[model samples]
Target chain A: MFSGLSAFPLTPMQHGVVDEVAFIRLIERLADAGVDSIGALGSTGNYAYLTREERARIAQLAEKHAGDIPVIIGISALSTRDVLALAEDAQKAGASAVLLAPMSYQPLSEEEVFGLYETVAHNLSVPLCVYDNPRTTHFEFSDELHGHIAQLPNVGSIKIPGVPAAPDAASVRIERLRTLIPSHITIGISGDPLAAIGMNAGCEAWYSVIGGLFPQTALAITRASQAGDTQQALRLSERLNPLWALFSQHGGSLRVIATAAELQGLAASPCLPLPLQGLDKKGRQNLARVLDELSLT
Target chain B: MFSGLSAFPLTPMQHGVVDEVAFIRLIERLADAGVDSIGALGSTGNYAYLTREERARIAQLAEKHAGDIPVIIGISALSTRDVLALAEDAQKAGASAVLLAPMSYQPLSEEEVFGLYETVAHNLSVPLCVYDNPRTTHFEFSDELHGHIAQLPNVGSIKIPGVPAAPDAASVRIERLRTLIPSHITIGISGDPLAAIGMNAGCEAWYSVIGGLFPQTALAITRASQAGDTQQALRLSERLNPLWALFSQHGGSLRVIATAAELQGLAASPCLPLPLQGLDKKGRQNLARVLDELSLT
Candidate 1:
């Protein structure tokens, strides 16, 4: 069910409530940009910060606004019971597949990680995509663990977090993973700046953060790289390097992306939940310069 | 408000509910063992896994059983809003002090971490102890950040996560932290194995996990070390080293402690929340043997 570029939008919030109108508009915009799918609650989607009820509302909004495009709703929680509950909710809300990350407040053992996916997978009729984003979840999936997870029932796709520092090494790693896992399982890549390299390496899809806000750019890069137009893909990646640089420096793109969205007049505020304040004054200046230079504004 | 050994009991759960009867018994046992204080909802207390309502109940139970001993309630949450709310509840439950960890799902900047404590501190009348447990919270407090947090209003103590690897280095680190912060702010040590080293280095208290289950052992170590009986303290610490080895190897003590608790017949089951399974057969055998050798059963 995974292919091409899947846009993951920021969960826009206004005064602590999810801004439903803005969220619907963002999904509609991504759908109109002709992306293959919409991921309603990926890392960039701020799934951890919101309540279950709020996340349920987001799933409905994504499906309502995404038109015919498949909607992959991120279903992550600290407990297996909560994950299964969210998966059931996602399925009821017309989600194409639910993205599962091994998120635990406590670091999970290998057996525990498997139990989480296996139990949740057993409950879901909709296909489950195993999301491997170590930066946020703090649980790194070993190549061996990936092999084990691939054999689980109802798990149809794998979203491999990109090795941004070394794309060549990532390509080699991706090749080995593909060889190890079942060919029936769709392999997708995330990490916006490195998506070009991953797509060039023959990964089937791009689970993209940047694409949610600027789908045309992400889609173009995926098409160029998949079509063997390395030059075009690299050029596009270079153009977005400033934004990627900000994401790297800040340790995450949630704040940077939200800031950019607000600067470009897309969102109401760049505010994240308190204790996670957005970029500083100097950061805002740099972000503004990058957006203006790229004509994103 | 902090001295000697403080016990942190695991929140016993049965059939997906907090076992209030078992919880009260655990607290009463700790008080009987003459622990300096009872820390409800410490890391072993499984504060993160519990709901707000469940946490409130635990606080009331802690106060009910902890007759004369002080009760230090752990108040940690992803948002400052929730943290404040929990702090208010902790105060109402008659807690002597509230332990606060800069708990964030996202990595926080130095400014944000300071703001979290400052904002929460303003609302909390009870003294706040800055809890620096990086392994669980994933947010490390540098010496500079510790100094900053110590200066916040109502902040009267700091719980420094002990570095058990290098006892000498940890002692030096503890000393430097003691000198950097105001003398009024009590310094406590956590991590069962390193508590002796921390106390020997002049840290006022041992925020002990093992103390909850085996308070006699922890208190003996504390009393011996605090009274300048290094040889006796070292002997007690060495006796508990096997359990500490399991904690160090596993990167956490939650499951290991739970297993030992069940083996000693304190709790009915070592069952942690689903997907966080307890020790395997080999681990259980090892833990049982250790407990038996120590005569803790």
Candidate 2:
């Protein structure tokens, strides 16, 4: 169930409030595109910026709108108690699996992180995905630590940051993790730009940012990678190089993705939470030009 | 208003609830020790682990027990809206100033961070202290960014990490910031181990961790430095070298600080929020030995 393409949607916010209508529409769009799983409240979803009430409602909305697509809800928070509470909410809202990132304010120690997963994993009814997103959560997981966490009960998958760019190096990286992680636990790849390489490198799934907006585009890469068509996957990924460049230039993907969603009329203007003005005029202009060139506009 | 020795007390918690009595006792200890200010909800205070309601009550308790000493509340949150709300609560609770760190799950851009300070600073009735805690917050601030933020009104101080180990280097480091920041805006140094060095290096204040619990000891260093007795200040810092080394070995100051407070019978055992174990048995033994040698226990 964890294998294949998992799309992370932006939980569109309008004027500091979750745009429930737009949010449901995003879920439906991903469902219509036949994505394997819908990752709601992932980093791109602005889950950390939201309150529990809003998050719980969003979880329900995702479940209601996702049709048969499995819903993986992000339950990351600073405190373990809060993470537990959010996990419970996600489970109640019919999440197929829950995603947990070591989202922190005080940079966490390894023991604390393991304890968090152990305690949360012990209590979970649904399987848990260890979200090793150093870019946002700022917690780097050692391979040994991931091995330890993967042994916890209800641990079903690990969503890792992108693999090495080179094909041989990417295979070696995943192979090392594979030796430690259990076979039941699927390894999914994030870092939208490198999704094709990671998937082609034997990742069971692509946990993508662009997949949330342009599922068809992301699927083209995912399906090719899955079919052992390495050339097609690489070719498709190269086409979106401009978008990936924008993501890097902007520091991260949330802002860039927000702009793309807004441009596509899928979300409101200034859809992101406060203090995160989506993209400046210059960035937007560049994005529009690139999207037009790629025929993704 | 943001000068001398500002003691940041822990908001002691018991079984996941704020230990009001113990928290108040810590506040009284700082106030009785004649600290220049009481910095409630600082990192040592575990501001990030707390809920908004927990934070608001902590702020009120801090103000109530602090007597005439000005109270500085840490109002940091992931969302700007929440930070603004927390700032309002702090002000309503009679805080002299509010401290904000760009604590993030999505690693923030420079503009997002500046906008956070700008928006929060504009709304604040009290002064705002820019909290540059890269160790905990994981957001690095450039000197140019500091210069840009310093121009915003109500930005009364910047709680910098620490200065260089060498006297000459420390002086140059603080002096460089002095040129960019407004003269009126105080440059306070944190990192408890280096507090004395920073103070002697011309830092206007010591935003201390140890001072939160051992106000008298920290003040001895602060007083010597304020008197321009660099030799005595350095000597005092050198004496506590064991404790500083423990903090480094243990990853950060909070857990070590929590252990010391617990040993002193000042806070409940395991006072830190869950997932942040105060210290393991081995770590505790090491800390206890160091505290005993320092005659702090």
Candidate 3:
């Protein structure tokens, strides 16, 4: 169901609680910017750290603000039962689709992996997108495995990290994957700024963390690429690339979301929960410079 | 509590359901051979392939057969909540301790890592052991972080894999950790055959999959080491080394468990789950030779 640019909004937190007002404003801005879909509580939204009730509330809030726009809820948990429960919650909250990450504790064999997806697919009452981010997962879904996952009845899309313009071996691998999966199944790209390039390389949708910080720029880039204006998309990518690099360099997607929230004046503190050290002073300064250059703050 | 050799018995499967009768018999045999502790549903136990109910039943059965002998439950799961629940169930089922692997999906930050342990520790009544097998989890617990986890109130032990032995640099790092944490926090060595050497190098527990099939030999080696009879322990280790090398050469711990189970007549089909291919004919034959030489059958 995902096409055009999808925004993974930072779940705004104020005083250790979901800041509903700030979150509504963030979603409203993306909707106004013509974002095709909004991903709730994906890695960019810090799904892992949120309590179940908090996550459900955020999904409901996104649905409320999204109106007719599609709200894809990130449905990653350590248990298949939990994932199914979350997917049901997302469906109940009016999510148009759900994104699932495999259980994280043990590296699952393909049989176990298929069983998990089959369990979710058979149970969930909405379109399912398999999230394949090996950086966080320490395990990549091989193209062959992805083909197997695609065979699941409810699986509608695949979300992979976006590739930069310069064709690396990894980029070539992505091209090979595009040729393998069913052409009808959506292939969504994560990793903002490179989203347009990934789209040019046959990805069906672009899910952006940067979209939360700079909705207008993200939308402009996405629309340009959709309208077959590669030159325009490239320019916007260039403008957003520095910030994307700065945020994603040190840790996982949490930093990207934190940076975006900071830029947009959404979250008061850019503090990430344990094990994830916050950006150093130099890193913050670098982000500030990027924001200043973009005239965003 | 795991002060000597620990045997993780394979959960025998017959036509896809847990062969409870075979499983209990295996545990009783291991106990009779003087195994110091019994581990249930470890990687060697084909845990990921088992359903939740099957895994719980295995733990419950192990506890029943264990009697006064310590039964350590492998409480590894994708979700922190599920793992905690498993830990609680394990405690209720008479398990002396629970083992936890890090939340698997992502390379967790040290804070998320500690948070996971804290969640499990706070929720369960029994003492917990942090299972740090990087070969499976694809993540390592750093020496500093290991010390921190060792200090957690309910954390009683650290299970580190025996491979990639502590180098000079690692030895210096762990020495610092040894100074920081309580001396009583048992260090359990996980890689088979290296168990004796690792135990000599400060590890308090030696977990052996081979022990399940050749309990007499496994217990003899462990007892010799416990009595501070290094010569005897070394002799047994030498005898077992060829078998260990055969099982570990291709598939590491999984192959060892499967091969040992076949020799023990515990499992009719010693098959590995997908993504992990089954051992080749030559590998199986080599494993047979080791089992025959050990007089395991």
Fnat values, candidates in order: 0.66, 0.84, 0.23
Candidate 1 lDDT by residue in tens digits, A239-258: 88888899999887788988
Interface RMSD of 1: 1.4
Q: Which digits, one per residue and each the tens of the lDDT, describe model 3 over residues A22-47?
A: 77888888777777888888877768
Q: What lDDT tens digits, residue by residue, belong to model 1 across residues B14-101?
A: 7777888888989999989889999999878888777789999999999988999999999998877678789888989999999988
Isolated chain A: TM-score per model? 0.96, 0.99, 0.91
- Candidates, ranked, DockQ: 2, 1, 3
> How does chain B of model 2 score on TM-score?
0.98
Candidate 1 collision pairs: none
Candidate 1 local distance difference test against the native: 0.84
Candidate 2 DockQ, CA atoms? 0.79
Q: How do all the candidates rank in terms of TM-score, highest first?
A: 2, 1, 3
Candidate that beats the other on lDDT, 1 or 3, i.e. the better one: 1
- The top-ranked prediction according to lDDT is 2
RMSD of each: 1.9, 1.3, 5.1
Tell me the lDDT of model 3 at B232: 77
Q: What is every candidate's C-alpha DockQ against the true complex, given to 2 decimals? A: 0.66, 0.79, 0.22
Give the better candidate number (1 or 2) by TM-score: 2
